[model samples]
Target: MTIATTGEADALPEILTERRGAVQWVIFNRPKARNAITPWMEDRLIEICREVDADPAVKALVLTGAAGDKPAFMAGADLSCLQSVKTPEDYTILEDRAETAAMALEAVRVPTIAALAGACVGEGALLAACCDVRIATPSVRFGFPIARTVGNCLSIKNLARLAAILGTARTKEMIFSARLLTADDLAGAGALRGVVPDDDLTERTQELAEELAGLAPLTLWTTREALRRWRDHGLPADGDADLLRLCYLSADYQEGIAAFLEKRRPVWVGQ
Candidate 1:
């Protein structure tokens, strides 16, 4: 199936949701910004996740970046959205919305696949990690390069998620080095279900979705939940809510965001 498009000019919705047979596609549609996530996008995605999760007709989901002049899976949070965040309250609100969306996606109770390519970073990486499976092109670059760019911290929940996928030492190296790993590297580490040619990405993702859609929905969902429960067992009871507030309210994080928007290097004062 051709990747679905809307409008004559292909004007994209923030969250482009399409139901194809028993598979649901929740596409991130801000390709110009590398599908960088916005707050509204977060809310729309959560709504879509809940909608599909509740639908008995839907058995699987495929999430990807919308086709654009420059195709990208997802780069992270939109810098413009980051610009508006000033206080701890502002940051908390943003994190809460993201957390809500992430939790909703995790709770979908269906097989979920992330069709990732190009650049997937920061929050985008976290989103992909939340999915049950990931597929990407060999050239894809992804990681939480916050140390070099945003200077913001991932909530312990997200850190744990990545750690579970990539292991503790590799996770440390990924963050501390502030480098994006090639798709091959991540795949070799068992982070991706498979790696395909760049041109075959969409088709491969669709094929996998269809295959998953044929499975017993109840069995698939229960297995996903079982793995999630085991993963959650490692998390601290209180969660990492406070960590988000701490980093979001920091002067270094503010400087990082401002510098990124200004297209300059961030001068970290380490507040």
Candidate 2:
């Protein structure tokens, strides 16, 4: 459907963008590929998150996959993109970008929600874990096939974040065996708020988002900040803080901010 305000469809084929009251709704646009995160899609995702962060009108955010009349959030990072990173350094750069995007989602001032419907696998699972709330559909499944498929290590930061959010035992089972968690199992394990039928998932998610939007803005923002800081505060003596500082100060950050305020799509010059 066309978005009357923007003169565009509410959702794009790659990523649907819309505003529902005080909530910024970003739906993954590629259901054909199970909503995999392509490199370009990753860039667009970060830009959208940055825009939401700067918008005072947005009180909450929702991330889900674009599945018509169904629930399927995202599959994971695009396997196609991984083919280019042959060397260790190349892989590290790719991970850095993904990590930056994940951190950006956490840094948003408003509460974020992720609706997991079908295949929330690999990097997609990690992204969902970072959100403040997660809702799943009956057919939803979660797993990271990285150990078996990618042969890449999950960063210590991601490991800690997942373990803290999902707890030690569940986290170990998730990462070690790379087993997929069914929606019912996740709900029982406290990973998701509840499991809805696929058809009702969007309605339920919107209901929760709207509920959050009605709250005192500062109250929610500060609460989110506190939770994030509490978890990120003890990050070990890695140069992550310094690196992240540099990223915020970089020319890309400035371009991103300017483009967002101008309400035009950013032309990211990956500096």
Candidate 3:
């Protein structure tokens, strides 16, 4: 995790929170890096998720990126930022922060809506999967492009969540191909609440959040728990850390990260 210096707590938060009527908006605020989050940022988001859970007045949550000229919801982790890692332990610290935030947000009693635009890749898309619903604009693109880029493995929790939403076959295809699925593709696969034009995304998201907020509270909480439990059930308990080590420790994995930063194709020896 990124540690703050003596008084870094006085600086602005990495993630931004805004309370709007009955909705709590959690925006991924790292715009220059496409909202690519650090371990510290993930911790902040997880804290926000917990705070929202404690507030009964917050009936719903809306997640989005800070809309900029390019407007990425969130993309793959900043390649340059991740290149500092030298050990499995270091990498796990970063990955686990993101995973913990996803689970925290997903477990909230109130519903979540990910209003996405632009690219949502890797851990970013994993966060969207945690939301109770997703809506996006035509400009949105979603994928895990690590196969061609980082060569890192997904955590068991992330893999299970993907499998639950897209099924095993489709998830495998997505990783193997390393292609970004467009908004339409994600909608067709049941990962989205259908596409809205870029201009209407905000309005549509608020409308959906309102609808969810007005539903029976007990039913919403119960059904969400029912869903959250199924995701963890029956997952393979063995070999997850081994898989992470085998891949992240490989020469090819280093090559992948280096080549990506250098804007060249990685030469993989597979060992």
Best by TM-score: 1
> How many angstroms is residue 27 displaced in model 2 relative to the true structure, after the best TM-score fit?
1.0
Output the lDDT of residue 144, model 1.
83
lDDT of 1: 0.83
**Tens-digit lDDT track for model 2 on 1-271?**
2212221223355777889888888877776577788877778879988898788898889988876333456777775565555444665678788988898888887889997888888778888988989988888888775433433456668877787667878878877886888887687778787788876877898899888888887898788788777877877856454554444444555554455346666665555
lDDT of 3 at 139: 95
- lDDT of model 3 at position 61: 92
CA error at residue 201 for candidate 1, angstroms: 1.1
lDDT of 3: 0.81
lDDT minimum window of 10 residues, candidate 2: 1-10
Measured against the true structure, the TM-scores of the candidates, in listed sequence, are 0.93, 0.80, 0.92
Q: Model 3 compared with the native: what TM-score?
A: 0.92
**Model 2 stretches with alpha carbons more than 4 Å out:** 1-12, 68-71, 237-271
Candidate 3 on 1-271: residue-level lDDT in tens? 1222213422546577777779888877766677787777778878888888899999999888765557678886766557866698876776667777888888877998999999889878988888889999999988898888878888787888887777888888999999888887887888888799987887888888889989998999898889888778877765488888888778888888899889998987888
Error of 3 at 250 (Å): 1.4
Model-by-model lDDT, in order?
Answer: 0.83, 0.74, 0.81
| Candidate 2 global lDDT | 0.74
Better of 1 and 2 by TM-score: 1
